[model samples]
Target: GKEQKQLASELARKGVTKEQAMRVKQLYEQQNNVNASNATGTDVNESRLREEMKENTSDMLEDHPSTQDLARSNQVFGRNIFNTRNLTFEPSVNIATPLYYRLGPGDEVIIDIWAASQNTIRQQISPDGTINIQKIGPVNLNGLTISEANDYLKKTLNKIYNGLNNTNDPTSAIRLTLGSIRPIQINVMGEVVQPGTYSLSSFSTVFHALYRAGGVSDIGSLRNVQLVRNGKNIATIDVYQFIMKGNIQDDIRLQEGDVVIVPAYDILVKVDGKVKRPMRFEMKKDESLSTLISYAGGFDADAYTRSLRVVRQNGQEYEVNTVKDLDYSVYKMRNGDVVTAEAILNRFINKLEIRGAVYRPGIYQLNGKLNTVRELVNEAQGLTGDAFLNRAVLYRQREDLTTEVIPVDIKAIMDGTSQNIILVKNDILYIPSIHDLEDRGDVVIHGEVAKPDSYPYADNMTLEDLIIQAGGLREAAS
Candidate 1:
């Protein structure tokens, strides 16, 4: 119960819900019970179990809703690549041996010789880098490629076997192939999820070692993963190259006792709003804003490309700046910078809307040919016959952004009597129908009528006509 409470407290500190904490505690107890039951005579590897427990806890924490919320709230990108359960990134053992694979201790080699007599020999390289032949004594195969080892073995065995060097003879042949591969111990240090020494395959690369170490940590730099060999930094692996362009040219093969170090991130910038893929990205020292945007998959379709806004932290206070399109390539990005690309305004530039009595009443373009009201009407197939040509209302926006109603004399404008008003952007012209101007009321006939209802009133109608329209008077009528 105490341990469960402690676990609950830790999860609570991480913003986990009470129900989630209980689920996590239940899983934890189940794991502990399993571990306890298997503790007897199982020869369990404590380090591997610890790593498994850590991975399980990480998986549970990653599944919490708060984790996703944190990720969307400007959390560092590429951190969750290692937190996934699907991609193990384990090295394949069934792949063909690489030509550049150097022979090392504990590696098994198979030698097949056929010339007048057939003989096959299997030898494992010793710790002293030498393999004992049947009659040729020990030959050092370590630090040599497969082709190099084959050439050396042929020269050493030519004294006992004839025609060994003859390439023209079809029956005479010597072949060298790798058998069971060896294991190499590597140390994965610095900002990685799990920093420890792992026994990996001799053919393993830097990526394989990283995967075995549970990948880089949340604060680690993927762009500068360094490979140290024999106290020297031999190579630097940039994961971004593989992620962005699928280029694995820098994923060099790992040697025994090699050290893979993931350093803390150098510079990070967040890009959100109107971007194809918005997230926080790690930046190199010399990378620009354009490179960062490209890493974010560029701007979205509705993005305002003319300029971008940047909120930068300048030591004591935050400073905001506008970056124009021309400066994107040259603008050097700094750490803790937030870049935003806003969407374009919803309003249109050369648009005018016509409602009510036009033939084709809708929106029209305010171009040179349709600049005047009369031209707009002509473009709309002229006003309808019932259109009130005496006065129409044109709604225009003033410079102060207030709506202004202008009374238009349509008859005079159509007849070329008055000056035609030029239309501007967002001008709404409304022509009313003549029926909308007349008051068409109805007459109500009640009490004494067979049907107590209202009917449309006509001019100079008598009460008898009104009663006839209401189905005449009833028997109880006065």
Candidate 2:
């Protein structure tokens, strides 16, 4: 009852209709009653009731004004990379420390001094970015590269030990190296799946921080990811460049207290039909239709490259415009634009087909040399001996897309008595065989015959011939 009241209150807050609210109340009551009655019933009954209730609730929620908008903004391209658990962007601790890596707090520094007497010292950088050496005193190494820190350390330790900086003095040598790396805190906010602060390794890049924050949200823009430092946007990282071309030039290493912001998309266009990859893609303002097509993996083999159809939303309504191939580079795409690459028409040009009573009947080219009906017949190795020469039908498609049967006098054309009929595109010529023109019945010799089977009838055949062909009559003949 308490849950029902809360649901009703939420529905009222959302301005849902009174009838809809009452329906939800009825469904809740039905669920409670079902659960109470099914206490002693099988698990299947309870599971079925739960499923039905869930489906009803989902249906009602789908009809809600707020959920309808969410349903429309479902999937976007390049957004599912982080949704999988199999892939991770965690920085490996086993990698060698980069030379350009700067020293910071929480990082361990190792100093090895060897001479007639060797000694090793290991110290972690304090919160104030200083590591204390036993005899050499405290040395600050903040915001300095590894090389710079090594030089500073060598100069500071030289005062305590003699000949520490002399390269020729192998007996008195010093080495400095990093031990354990530090961890940096990064804030990933704005249109991300999980917008919060993430504690990550200092060696982590922009991708690592995004992975820790559960990647960009559905409405987030992957094309313009900003890397903000000290309240200033330092770098703009385009994830599409990395996802498409595997170029991670802009994936800079993170610093302490860095911010990775994934703002909402600026322009989103969908490319559908006859493309290698058909889906919605986020584009930048300066990008053109050609760039969008490249993101969709170019056009499929059967795509009509001559032109494309684009539907753009103008005010409250949508207007369609046909984009030619020449204008693909210049055409600017707008938000909510849908571009379609339709397949070429399923019709062939400069082709003709011939079948029925032909020696080698098949498709033939309708070129200048083979334009007439006589030439097409000759290209098909001429017609068979049983071909009916009186009339042949040519199925031709007209401009209206309707089939028109044109009768060709094959006998007149072959005899050169009539003018040769010129063939057009997609014309199917059919010359009927003589047998197809007439029905030849079969003769059945049953009962008294030795072979009681049907035989094809022939002209000028007598009863004696029929009996002989049937292996003579049986001895018990009627």
Candidate 3:
């Protein structure tokens, strides 16, 4: 009791009122079952209790967090989910067409010969990789490019169809054109949904081959996707660029022996705060901030998009930085970057707090002289399904610190029977939720009645009517 009095005196000296100090002392005494009247008890039980209390009090004091630690814990960059994983390739979106696409068997070619009599022949490369032209017989076109084949065919045809004119000079003209190119067999291996060799059109790209092989698997990394030609890595594919901005720079054309390798997804970045979906998203190398945001389902309606933050994963901690510019496409995202979208805090002097029974319940910006309760309600998407609009209360804090609770009948105002109330700054509009219909306007019957349950109160309801509705009085009724 002496120790409790000392603590109460300390609390009172530190600005706690006598009543609050007494309450705290009484609460402590009740919780610990300590008697203040016999504070200096020397019983063995009292000593043990005092020791336990001392141990618990010491532990609590020791566990109390410092201000600096609290501040650090409350920082926005805390709780980052990004992992530091080295990326292999930076995403690129500049695919150049293969200028020397090889000709193979099954490729069709058109040959035109003009010598004495014009003759045109359409032929396909046989399985032996040779084309049989009229008169010229078989010509090997295996492993030849379009330009090389054209040159080779024209030279051979011109020589065979050469016919001397009166001047004794060779007067043969030959035209060669490539028809349908043969489908190229591409091997799609690695972490794709289906890994196998697929025959795609000669014009098919790496993405097309991936599609033919059922695309990358769920655990596949689009950023580290590799295109290998003849056992050599040709290009890195970053599908995010194509997904976000329709960029196909890395969608290089596939060739025979080309392999589309979808490696396992290993890079991750975290996105939180004011976004439709806040979670850790897998990212490919060279993806921009805009792509990451799109992956997270874009910004929320309440997001302050003007300025967002990114917490870069440093060795043992995170480095937070704010990005004020809205052009996120140009900013390349790293693997361990945490993107955070801030919400607009109602810091302006002209604001209203609209709470409960509304689609959007928060602080709303108010315009002077022009802002009204109806306009604010409309901005909040009107009332919720269970809103009690008839009994809406508006709490206004006066300059002298006194609060005025004004009852509002929103249904009457909407029906044009009541005047529209103009709302001022700092007004708190609370729309109550609908209660159980049976509990509304109810009257409770006390003891001595047959049924002591509450009944719905009606205009001019007599005690006898209530008694009859409550199943009448019991025999012991007073």
Candidate 4:
């Protein structure tokens, strides 16, 4: 009871009522006492439990069910907090060709002479399997590797020099160097932002290559990322584990001219049928379907939450058997996944229609943003022809499932001012045809202007600028 009272005091300090705290403390003490008695341990129920709780006020209890679940599947290199990004782990040097190896045709090399820069070189063996150096002439080293070629060169140099200069220490003086293999560039495609050739000076992990290619696409997921090599799907890297658990093994080393493609975030849950807002939505980081749906504008009035379906897109397509709750969204999304919220028995969501003179004209996605029209217009290619640059409408469904349209202004775009608007996906932009448009601006006629319409939008016009040609702007004009 005294131990229970101390626990109550601790609880009081934590803003937890003393009554419930005392109750749980007593129950715990009784359970412990009974266990001790049965074991013949004669251990008394001391105040240690209360003291422990007090000492650990900042740290969460290991016994917390939430914490246990968090640690469920996060173990890399025996550390749950390992970072896959910076293995900081200089993995056992990936001696590409065992370091001091030789080079051949198709094998890259760098030769640097300590005494002379002209003699030192960084180049690949020619197709003819020969290298032409400044002083050494052409050396036939087609089949030899880096080491073999160096030895041959040393022997030849010694033979010639000893005969002429009478140097006894010929072999020991020559120091030939074979530079590292030329950097290997990998082709990165798919959903990456800056997709291009990335050089590989040394053996680097997948993440390193990705950094070179400018990180993954915004919609790309680290979880279930695929790395294909030699026209074969060699490995599927777990990006999340690399992220959460710091797994570096997944960051495999890359080879020359390897194509690293980042497919678009394919795993998507479709909010269709009866969802309040229907569209394809990406699974947020460390998020669930419950959170995702809420972000998708919650369940439609007719949405039957119990009948939700998660259709995932792999290479082709496959329907997940069934999903019980939002936690199912945690299932690593692949390239494409459609999550559908079935219509409820008695309710129905209203339909919206969009059309206009815009970049891409279509029934675009509707997120109910006032400026979403601008985004759709840009996507469709901006307004063409004689588009109504003045105003746009926001059509929304009322809680009663009825439609409401609100008009918006967009003249600021023409002036090259104001922020460009973001288009909600799937929006319809109507564009008419456009004719030629002309504009006249400030002008200066220093030399001549035949009809006085020559000077236009140009910078730093001087007397020489006016007389660009021997005849000037024109004979009569000048």
Candidate 5:
């Protein structure tokens, strides 16, 4: 009752009048008090029952309604909220056989000289791109191949070991071998997922760097991915080509301080009219008409493949005569282009009329070339039981613009006695009813008549006589 009174007060504050609020409070107080006491007028038992219900509800809530169990039962993985199109291009990576490893800053090398004194030393290149050796001073090793660095180090060390003129000797007094390569830090910016600076191995390619950066995002374009080094675009990678057919020519090895900039997807083309997957497709660079068609899951079976046309953004129309010789090179596509694959047109004769006692008589379409009367009758599920087979008439229009009525023997044709007649376009076949009773002379009394019905024929059946036979017209009838 106190809770009900508080709720009524809230309702009064929310636009209910004071009198109405009091009435609602009193009504709830009556209902709540009605079940508060037993027939003996004692409320102790009711209070005990309420406490037991609360305990039971609390126990039920704690037993099997665990949040972790509920979440585990409903958890799902790999469920994408947005539709993703799988579009892959040929891979075109230009790579050669392993030849030489270049020595740069952070590259380690071990130098061993086997002479009067055994001198073995391990040195890493300094920040200035040089390595300091005993008696050889600082030697620039940046951008020098392993073979070149080894030769330079040998030539310098030979000056201290033997004589500089002894460089022509094939046998060197010192032996050097390349050690570990340093990790490079590159930046992946723009529309890629988790774009940031990533530390990778010096031998890592562009694909490895991209994988570390979480690859491109949903809106990222795969066509014009730019690789920037020293504020210049070193290469534009088309991952579509690599994805379609292992042609990773542009998957260049990443250098230190390299930046991969992925731009937003910009190209979009719409496909409609007799396509299996008719939807707007996001296009990659150098995408042509053929590529777009394939992106739309190819043309449908009824598609007029030869009659493909495209409407460009500027309203310019382009058509391809044949899909056989369709060279995507010649028929390039652009953004906002609308491509349509027309359907094969219906050209065969299709209209015919069948009236009277035939079992499903109506105007039917004879789409086939050799549409005969037997086929048309079969299509209508044959004639009715009361059909006059002997008096069947076939009315055809001649080329000279005259109607020709030909009597057909349907019974003989059905029994294989006579050849069934071939039907033409726009032919009308009528089968009369077998019950050829005399035409009853009657007058139809309808609309504005008191008794709207048919009256039998008389010697002189006038409109007045018909009206009299149908009973007098009411006042509302005219």
Candidate 6:
């Protein structure tokens, strides 16, 4: 207590009031003796607490992110819906919306003076943004807007006129009108029918740009339009909504240096397996399974239309049985869908050989379909000029190697009585042909393929997968 008095006195000597010094000393003593902080029986050891915190943080990093935590993130803030309406600096086109601006250096301006030519004049704001009038001498307009500049000029001109013509009162006020850029210029590019910079009489919106760009290429999609400003992506406009839904708000006005990019339409579904034509067909909005089947020249007789599988980009699939459809001709298709049709040849469930002459041919998807008997014949080059129609049969077997051969009469099936055996998963077909003894072995494919192929098969393996495995198929060759 005596020490406290001395400390208080010392504090007082440092210009602290006697009351303040005493209060601080008393408070310090009480806190030290009584332990003002939260007193805890379970004292946390710093090192142990730190280690536990580290482990907890590591565990949090490992566990899949919880939806609750994800929702609070900024990304989710705009996920459901958010806007930058509060933003002040939204660059806009020259004139779709009348924008007001004060004058700046390099900003052109036109002024109208009713006075005679000998009295009034046309003048440009100087580099310093100031203009000098004949009678008004040097009127400082630097950093002032056109309206402000006019006010300054009018006041000065009125003063001079009132001095020159004492009878004419210097009471006329000034007015300023900011004019629009008569010919606004903008650039359009990428997947457009007519891509170029267009000069607009007034600042126009994205629609005018597309019109100036020759209204987009046939393959261009207006739905996902990109509006770039100052070499940066400013907006992702839904032009489709702007046109079809009549949502004018979606059509934002464009500014100079704003590049409008209309992305190319994604209109393709990969038709593989058992089709007469295996290619990417440009899709239509009203397209269905029949459209794709017809695009692939309809189904082959042996096509396992029942096991029609649609593989999407992420490996997720929607498999349908065209055979189960009863009609077997209509299934709606989506972009990037991989339609897998069943093969006609008999498969050995898990064991099969692709003994055929095809480019990079081999045994593929166990039950992956190879089209009509004719397609198989073509894969093996139609029995190598030595095959007999009577000897032709699609051989099948159980996993135990129990074998059964079904003679396939190509002509009879073509005439339409054949069930045209549908293909199944893991079913391998054997297209056998007499091989020249000097051939030593069957055709082989390797090095960069998902499944290195040795036998010549037509289906199962895809060109993309093959290229991915072959170190991306020497680009120079492509």
**lDDT of each residue in 26-99, candidate 2, tens digit only:** 77567668767765765676577658766766677667656433343345778877667765767788877677
Model 4: residues with Cα > 4 Å off, grouped in runs: 1-124, 127-183, 196-205, 228-230, 244-247, 250-253, 264-478
Off by over 4 Å in 2: 1-74, 112-119, 160-164, 167-175, 409-419, 442-478
Q: Candidate 5: deviation at residue 156, Å?
A: 3.5
* Candidate 3 residue lDDT tens string, 1-478: 6887776565544455566555554555664565445556537556666676556444544555545544443332211211212321222324432337677888887767676748877888899999886676899988887778767766676655655222356576555566667777888889776799887777778766666666566566766789888888878887766655678788786777788888887767778778876766667567788877788788999899887799898788879888766668778778668788989875458888888888998888888643777777878888889988667889998889689999988778756788889888889888888753335478878676666798888878998988887878887886
State TM-scores per candidate: 0.74, 0.74, 0.49, 0.28, 0.46, 0.30
Model 1 lDDT, residue 159, Cα = 68
Q: For residues 1-478, what per-residue lDDT tens digits would candidate 5 score against the true structure?
A: 5755565555544454566555544554454576565466346655654465445434444543355544432321111111233322212234331237676789787877764536887999998998887776898889887777667876677677664236465343665666677888999999777799988877777777666666677667677789999999989887656655678788887788999998887776677778776766667656677887776678888888865767665656553334342564457666666777889876336688888877798888876643777777777788888888776889998888699999988888766788988888879998888665346667788876678898777666678888787786888874
> Model 1 residue 127 lDDT?
100
**Deviation in angstroms for 388 in model 5?**
21
Question: In model 3, what is the error at residue 23, expressed in angstroms?
Answer: 30
Give the least accurate 10-residue stretch of model 1, judged by summed lDDT.
41-50
Count the clashes in each prediction.
0, 0, 4, 41, 18, 19
lDDT (Cα) of model 4: 0.54
Each candidate: what lDDT?
A: 0.86, 0.85, 0.72, 0.54, 0.70, 0.54
Relative to the unseen true structure, what is the C-alpha lDDT of residue 182 in candidate 1, on a scale of 0 to 100?
Answer: 94
Measured with C-alpha atoms, the lDDT of residue 398 in candidate 4 is: 56
Backbone collision tally, model 2: 0
Per-residue C-alpha lDDT of model 4 across residues 283-309, encoded as one tens digit per residue: 434666675566556776656777467
Better of 3 and 4 by TM-score: 3
